[model samples]
Target: MSLEPKKSILNLEAYKPNFGASNLKKIIRLSANENALGYSPRIDKELKIGGFNRYPPQHSEELIKTISKIKNLDQNKIILGNGSDDLITVIAQTFLKPGDEAIYTEYGFLQFPQSITVAGGIKKIAKDINFHASVDNILKLITDKTRLIFLANANNPTGTFISKSEVYRLINNIPENVLLVYDAAYAEYIRNDKYTDGSELVEKYNNVIMLRTFSKLHGLAGLRLGWGYGNSKLINYLMAVRGPFSVNSMAIEAGIIAMKDIDFQNHCFDFNLKSMKHMEIELEQLDIKFINSSTNFILINLLDKDKFSAKNAVLFFKNNGVLVREMNVYNLPSHIRVSLGTEEENKYFLKLLKKFIRKNDS
Candidate 1:
């Protein structure tokens, strides 16, 4: 036998991360949609004072309890991961096999297709109507070989959300033999009453599994703590495949404390609420098209300037010490994604953007 990795591994393009700690101080970094408030102070205390020598729980026992209380689901249904990305991979590992198929919206998170490939499976791209993923379109993509349907709420790059009624209809029509994975990593950012994080459906449908993370609202992105909740039957299967101690010891200690820090979570939520409103007001005056978002980030469709796409504008921002996400890889070269930031950072970015747009006209 040849000394080589799996053929699938050779074909896969690894997920690219944009910012690192060193690059952080050099630019504004609105690319990742990371919480601008930074880590919870409690996370800081836990890191310096929390013990790192011990082996953390392989599955989240207590952390799931809080999530159970928050989501109103039984604790037995949850499985933990290093991050929601890991949870996504775990789903592929458990459910998808060689020659099986996974379906996702055309503009879903980049990791969805990558995860399916990592499991030696093929990915089928379904269409999205405008910014929202069309559930009906996804239904049409299902075949006898399709084992999974991966969905991103308030979808990546576009930052658009599917309505709750549409979600309910999709799950009802979906075949019981197929698994549906709800990747709601940005679920915490939504304030709408109509929004259902798929918790109710997960209760009603054994085929559905939902994933969440401590990265966004809790400001624990660096810690990499994330989890999935579904029926105990599904959770057990994931646990069997997931590596032991995949979630770090320090992250568990930090997570327990961070979950209890409700005050900090609310503060971050309110901050995003204010920043999103203000940024929308500023963008409106420019008369540029944008997607309506109910998440922490927004899709900005910039006015074309001298044959320049939004991808070019992103590099311009980077050159000027600001950073934002370019969506060319997501098949969205005409747009960019920006996370809500601090009052000062938002003002600085707006000033720079206005100057760039103005110069193009002059």
Candidate 2:
């Protein structure tokens, strides 16, 4: 007889990165929302790479200290992980039990449902309002069995975010028993004065945990480093469940340098703002509709779906050596999310987009 896994594992459709366009050459990869300007130059010059023979630091104290210092977060309330995904899983395992329900918005991070399911928990999806997370919709899903709420401020794929006031409304009303998992992986990219990463809520509420990553703006996706901040009691619980030495030595060293490099961060932030503005202008000129983005990527809506569907657009971009993310997984078949690339890459993307429209219009 064949061995069987849990029923919840069977229900999961495995999460795949590089969803499509795998065979394409990909001259300009705007699929993943990575730092277009790349990591800080200081990482190359200042990073001290060593300690291969020994185990990494048990707690990654140095890296945490750097993060705490820069982010103005408490040191005791912080915990590091392989990536934000790892931290999410740790949170799920720490709090969720079998049959407990975890809430996430319609367009929230794909990893939220996966982590909750893997921990033998039920997944409840709150409907989004015009591609934006609805605070009321999320609150309505909560029940006695609800143990967690996974919310991504400046959510991925759609690139839409609710304001700080809405976030406060959600947090203030939710039962204290339900832990709020605030995923802020794209927080660095947002410049809107109305936005808050929900980090402040961690200080005021024992039930709130805020997650950050070195992957996006830090250009350390390959290194896979992320951290979480919460009340000390909650963080202690996560640390207890997390694997020992989950964070590698190189990731710790690099993350510390990345955190300290404010000049590089500023450069990236400015470039992203400029590129995003340029893309928005080009999209408007071409009469293409897109969600006004507060993150590094924009969700291009194929308004005339019958004439130029997202599926056809993806193929066209792939054929032209540009790879963009398809939104089918997020149940957004008519939309494609394009990450902001270098100046030349963005130009190429806009040019091809214009060409595609003309060809289709003809």
Candidate 3:
């Protein structure tokens, strides 16, 4: 017999990131929800790496300690991964058995399905209300087989979020056997008073794991550092499944400095808020419909799909040396997700977008 991969792995769709005009001399990339202001300058000055010859700490102890101090969490209850994506996959592997079901909203992060399917779990989708993760709908999808629920607060692509009350409602309703994988990659960007990042729930509930990443606010995407906080028992299970030395020394060193760089983090947050607001106003003035964002990115909704579909808009932007996320992967064929960029980058993107609109009109 010919060698073949598992059927579940065969059925999985690869995650595609927006790689805009890499060959271009200068391309404004606002596709991936990356930190526009870039990473902390303190990382450059303060980060030290001495042991290149040996394997890094298996548990990323120092990094975890730093995160624990900053977030006031139990270090024993925290687990580090190569990135949040790695943690997600480990969660699926540790929890899901063959034919088990995991629920996520319609527009949830694509990694949820990928991880679940890879772990031989059935993927269940709850319909979102107006691109928002609806608590009631997610609860309705529960069954004897459901083992995990993946929810991204200040969700990517749509950039919409549910409040703390709604999150609690979901938590209170879901069977304790079912683990809620709360992905809070964008938590650093949220200024809303209602958002919780779901860390507190992890403390109270044994079945909940709150996932976080330094990729976004800390501008450590390239380094691929992320972490999860949950009950000690749950964290222990994840740590058992997590690869030894998954987190490298450079990432650990950088993460420690990045976590402590409060000034740099605030700067990124402030800049994102201001730039996003400016872009929102500009989109309104141009009569372009877009979602009100709670995170660093805005979702530009091209309502009249026949005239200005996301596919066409993405092509236009790419041609004009501007890269933005086309949302067809999330089944949002008429929308594009634009990450907040530097002032000049934002202006250039708007200008090109305006020009694209004019061209479409003409």
Candidate 4:
């Protein structure tokens, strides 16, 4: 018998991530936007001390309580994921079905629509600006068929962000029926008092579901723990759809530790904050155009249009052991994204970048 595949799986393209053996360089890894120092002391201790016994708490009830305490949220309103990526998939599965449509910005996180497609929904792409999600364009594109709208804050590969006022306006304009997914994976990096992470906003705006991750700031990328704060009714539905043990023991242990070790997390966040400022100053001095990042990554476009494509610059950086991502797939073939590293690593990266810029100048 022939094993015939479904048309959707046959046609669907897998989301291509930037990390792999090819990006394993000796100098510094500035591509993935992961913390350089790795997980904190408490996380390390607890993972080892707690032991990955039978499994993580079947429902992540304690984890939800911990997050609620940290964010001052209602435990009932939160749902945990293996990683925030899993949360995205579960949301897609819960809300989307065949013939439904999910919308996202053209150059936002490349993976946002992959979940939608995996859920058997047609993904609609809206226009963008500076690679950030454009709410107006998204509003224009929404229809009765639209089931979900994913808005990635401080979007990947571009690192540009939308202001609070803008996001609020967009939230207000969205119709009550369509689910609005505010992906705030990098929201922990925000230093501005005016900015809202959407966790708190979701309580007020029942249509919104907001994601938060321990991967970026808490140095727990390896642990792969995250949660979504959403309306209680929606969260209850997700609880039914998600895997009972999607979060492993080690990850929950790590998340528990990471949240408690606030001082260490703040140190990492502050370091990235300062590093981002200095980097912007250096890029400006070098006369290179770049986007202002709201997170621990910098997106720069090499202006030597005649000589270097983003891929070529990526090649140049790769040979020099500085791993960065080329934004060709994002429809911006001329830009590259570099992540924040420790002070020493940033110095090394800057040296390599200077060499590349000068060589390309000729």
What pairs collide in candidate 1? none
What's the C-alpha lDDT at position 277 in model 3? 81
What is the TM-score of each predicted model, taking all chains together? 0.95, 0.97, 0.97, 0.94
Clashing pairs in 3: none
What are the lDDT scores of the predictions, listed in order? Answer: 0.84, 0.90, 0.89, 0.83
What is the lDDT, from 0 to 100, of the residue 264 in candidate 2?
94
Ranking by lDDT: 2, 3, 1, 4
Q: What is the lDDT of residue 307 in candidate 1?
A: 53
Residues 1-362, model 3: lDDT tens digits: 98889888875678888875466788888898888788999888887868799999998778889999998988999999999999999999999999999999898888988999999999999999988999999998999999999999978777899999999999999888999999999999886788899989987888889999999989999999999999998888898999988998999999999999999999988888889889989998988888898888888888653488888888888888888998877777889989888999899998988888888888
Residue-level lDDT tens digits of model 1 in 1-362: 77888878986677886662433456787888788898679767665454667777777677778777866788988888999999899899899999999999999998899999999998899998887899989999999999999998867767778878988888888889899998888888887877777777788999999888898888888889998889999989999988888998777778888877888988888888888888898888876677887777888887444455887788778877788888878877878888877788889889988887886667
Number of the candidate with higher TM-score, 1 or 3: 3
After aligning candidate 4 to the native by TM-score, how far in Å is the CA of 18 from where it should be? Answer: 2.6
Q: How much does each candidate deviate from the true structure in C-alpha RMSD? A: 1.9, 1.3, 1.2, 1.9
Provide the lowest-lDDT 10-residue window in model 3.
301-310
What pairs collide in candidate 4? none
The alpha-carbon lDDT assigned to residue 114 of candidate 1 equals 92
Error of 3 at 315 (Å): 1.1
- In candidate 2 the C-alpha lDDT for residue 272 amounts to 90
Candidate 1's C-alpha lDDT? Answer: 0.84
Candidate 4 lDDT, tens digit per residue, 241-353?
Answer: 99988889878877887887888888888888899998998888877788888888988888544566788888887877778888877777788889988888888888887
Candidate 2 C-alpha lDDT tens digits along 218-302: 9999999999999998988888999998999999999999999999998999999899899999988877899998889999998
